[model samples]
Target: MMKILIIEDEPSVRVGLSFTLESKGHKITTAENGLDGIRIFEREGFDIVISDLRLPGADGIEVLKSIKNISPDTGVIIMTAFADVKNAVEAMREGAYDYISKPFEPDELLIVIDRFIKHKGLELENIRLKEEIRERERFQHIIGTSPAMQRIFETIEVIAKTDSSVIIYGESGTGKELVANALHNLSPRKDKPFIKINCAAIPETLLESELFGHEKGAFTGAVQRRKGKFEAASGGTIFLDEIGDMPLALQAKLLRVLESHTFERLGGNESLTIDVRVIYATRKNLKDEVKANRFREDLFYRLNVLPITLPPLRDRKEDIPLLVNHFLKMFGEKLEKSDLAVTPGTMDMFMEYDYPGNVRELKHSVEMAATLCKGTKIERWCLPAEIRGDGETPDAVISVFDDLPLTERVKTFEREAIRRVLEETHGKKKEAAKKLGISRETLWRKLKEHGFPVSPSDLEE
Candidate 1:
């Protein structure tokens, strides 16, 4: 049963509405005035609020504004006997879910309440579904079945429930922004705005106003009051990407907002309060920054309430094939090349190189291969020179020396090159075979003959 609040100054009307709503199997709470109703509404949780338009002390509009300020998700219906179209339009403009006329049929009021309640239910369900989709997308984007990534997933699940500040730390190109998006999408504020500000991208002089808004004539270009990311993200989440690059002066202001959830517009004394969840991501070491006095220690503590570290792609090489396949499908669809397929030899070539640029580099490589491949299959020649060692064909094994006796040299340089490729590719025999210009079966036989490990799992570890 949904909880409904009835706020009307008239004793008879309030009691009648309460009785009718209670009869409909809803738990009802009655208030004699708008002030009392707002207090109860703030102190207690209700699914929907029904407030009379005219009330003593605080008016219905004020109550509706307060309700929206506290919880935008709550459904508010304004009741008015004045019957002024202007008042109804104003109430709707101020975010009232709906307006009800006084002296209305009990069934009419019930229908309005039922419809709004159903809408609220659907809204909540949609938010939940969106969050699930975001989580799935985040997982799909970061292909890693390693223990490190699994732990990160578990941490994301636990922290997404609260509006606490989050700090994500990782190496460059480690997908910190992706993690930030995951946090915002999984949070309760998922349905609301999810604003991202790249602190490093914007100029330091403008970053303050960009975050806390500014009043008209606040600066040279300030002609009218402008809402910043924080205000725009009211009742939602704001992702501060590359926050470690934020100016020291702005960091203090950010700390103030985090401490009180209140901030004044630039060049304005009026302080505005917003309910915004902050998620910060950065590649810089905040602790080192703090020690060097570049980053505020207090602000660091505030943002680092729940810290998450993303493992580098190199650290989880086992995920390379999964990432490759994912990127292949993604870029193929994006480029309209659905028939694009990487030869086993070409894939092996990929395993040989250490992707210093991480997942981003891998994605670019896949897109390039898909674009450059003229034939149905992407060949070794399609891959970059760094990936394809010595630019040899897959089936051709390098001959170290034709003049040297077999007994004089125990190992051929060709065998050494193949072993090096296997090591680089993390032992995925198919990837190794591609790198060595050999078939998967040949690579497997060669590995068995040479006592070299040849599984994706072995390579990953």
Candidate 2:
């Protein structure tokens, strides 16, 4: 049921409309004047308002404006006499949903109310779906559990509540953008726009217009006026990725905006003020670039206000198992291979390898393995050559495992020995157990403990 408010100077008309709407299962509130209607609308949160165009103390247009100012989504229908149709048209222009003449039939009002309800329902549903997508993207795409990542996450939680300018420092593919996104999503301005610009992606000649907007005929191809990322992100955040690569000339301009919160579009003399938080990410060392005279020192300090450095994946090898499992479940459902599993040998190889491209490389490696593997289990052969550790001797493997704890060392050695025996026997589990001098049930227990499949399909030799 809906809440309907009727505001009419004529008591008979107001009561008649109220009775008609109430009969349709809608709760009705009738007011004798515009002031009383506005008060009732504000206090009771009416879904639809019907008001006479001409009123006593205040007019219907005034009440309409007041209601919209408080709740823009509230549907308003102006009730005007035949001679006041011009005022009704003016009300519609000022955002009145619809207008009905004073002598209108009850069915006409009901039809408009039904249409508004359907439209509102669809709009609310779209908002919910968008929020769900954003929630999944924010939490699922970012994978990390190391101490370094935990510190970064803690910093994000603390600083996201503030409107501070932040600088995220990390190597390429280290998920700097993911950190920036988390900060935006957790901030007060999450409902507003989040504009992202790759400083290195666009040419230097066009970078300024992309950041500060451009007027018509601003340049050779500026045929129409356009608002840039800063203007679009007026109430939210603007993420500047690869900030170190931005031209030195543009860096000075960006610094000016950061300090004053104002900028003029290209070929426009009028300055425009904007309210936006800035987040910068870079793979290069800005201090070194400043010393080398490639980056402006002032701009570097301005962007480095709240610094967060993300650790490389090789430094957080402990997270590989969790990340592997996450991607396996993700891609398994994505690719329609729901029962896929990686052998313990493959996981050991992954744990030992160094990832220069960081988490991005690991995700891609898993995706590729899942896509290309024909069997239910992912084997060492399904992995990339560098990740397989094929040429590494036992001593070399020991060196890689040296930094891990004693328990991890034992697990790594056991996984490697079982893998080698399984390979020698062409994935015959019983024969491989005999070769490893362990019983079949014991081998199965070890495989289970190491996240390997104990069946023939899990071997994938």
Candidate 3:
């Protein structure tokens, strides 16, 4: 129910309107004058405001302007015995929902109020939906539900509580930055800023100054004192991506900062202290870099204190269908359509190909399919050419020649097909059995007859 405020100088009219609105289940409050009405409006938020055109002291127009300035969304309806054309037009121009002449029927007032309430409901719902969309977009950076991801989640839970430096180890496109964000969101410092720097993206010559900041005339281009990532992320987290690409000489300075939580700006001897959490991520193996004396051993140990590794997509094939469904729902909502489901055949095709770019590549493929799929169901044809190629299909199971021992060859092929299906489906026995057009019991019997390995782990290379 909406809360409504009624402003009228006449005591009888004010009581009558309040009683009528209250009978309709709206919460009602009354003010004798426009000034009192504005005071009540400010102290308590109201969904709709009903006020007379004339009132003692501050008039209704002044009250309407004040209420609107405070909360523009509060619907205002103007009522006046003097039905001047100029007054009606000006009230509407001033953002009143509608103007009603005095001696208006109760039914007419009810109808107008009902319509305005309906419109307000729709507007609120739209705002809520937009907020939900924005929240989902923000969380889209982190996407995974595999065993490897579960472990990462556990690690994030533990590490987020502390302000310790972290080093994330993963291949390119493994969402290292997403992990960094998750850390920030889960930490007590969530309200603070999160600063990110890509060591490889910036030139080595400028990187030191970029990180440690610079004082005026520190270098040729240094015109004024500058704050760097550490200072910017003070009391927050700074994610240094591709830290393995940092120059060897700078590694010493970085190690000192990590050890002491202090650094000197370029050409400035004043030591600046920062209370920032440093999270580093790199595609290159730091252990190998340290062995080659390219990365500092002490720095490696310091950053690697709380390491999190993201597994590639190939190793977590079981998560593809889940990820595909998630992306389809996400894109469908973004495009203002009902959710689309991928066909089993399309899922089979996705399972067969090796995603070279891991989860990032899979997301791109799903987005492409969702865009191309005109129908509610996404088919194999909607998939990218690389994923839809003929080479990935199970044509080997199809007998081209009918000449050689038909029944025996067919049985052998069927068994092999079932095994291959099982492998592709990640040893979900029931799903594999269904895919092979056999009962679960029959698949189990066949597995026993063939002496197939009992453990699902045996299928992995």
lDDT of each: 0.80, 0.85, 0.82
Clashes of 2: 0
RMSD, one per candidate, in order:
20.6, 17.6, 14.6
- Provide the global lDDT of candidate 2 against the true structure: 0.85
Model 1 quality (TM-score): 0.55
Candidate 3 residue lDDT tens string, 256-287? 88778789899999999988888999999999
Minimum summed lDDT over a 10-residue window in model 1 is located at 393-402
Q: Name model 1 segments beyond 4 Å from true.
A: 1-140, 389-461
After best superposition, candidate 3 residue 284: deviation in angstroms?
Answer: 1.3
User: What's the residue-level lDDT of 404 in candidate 2?
Assistant: 84
Best by lDDT: 2
Q: Per-residue CA lDDT of candidate 1, range 1-461, in tens?
A: 88989999898888898888888899999899989998999899788999988899799899999999998888899988855668888999999999977779899888888898788789889999898556545653655667888788889878989878888999888888878877878788889999999999999999999998999999999999998999999999999999999999999888888888799999899988888888899999999999999999998888887899988787887777777777888877876778777888778878777877777877877776675554568776556545667756443432323466874234444444565685588546668777788777766666655544346453333
Return the clash pairs for model 1, or none. Answer: 345-434, 348-431, 351-425, 394-437, 394-438, 395-437, 426-459
What TM-score, computed on C-alpha atoms, does each candidate reach? 0.55, 0.56, 0.55
Model 2, which residues run further than 4 Å from truth? 1-140, 390-461
User: Which runs in model 3 stand beyond 4 Å of their true positions?
Assistant: 1-141, 390-461
Local accuracy of candidate 2 as per-residue lDDT tens digits, 348-445: 98898889988888887798678655558986655655687668665665566588899877877777677667656866887887888887778888
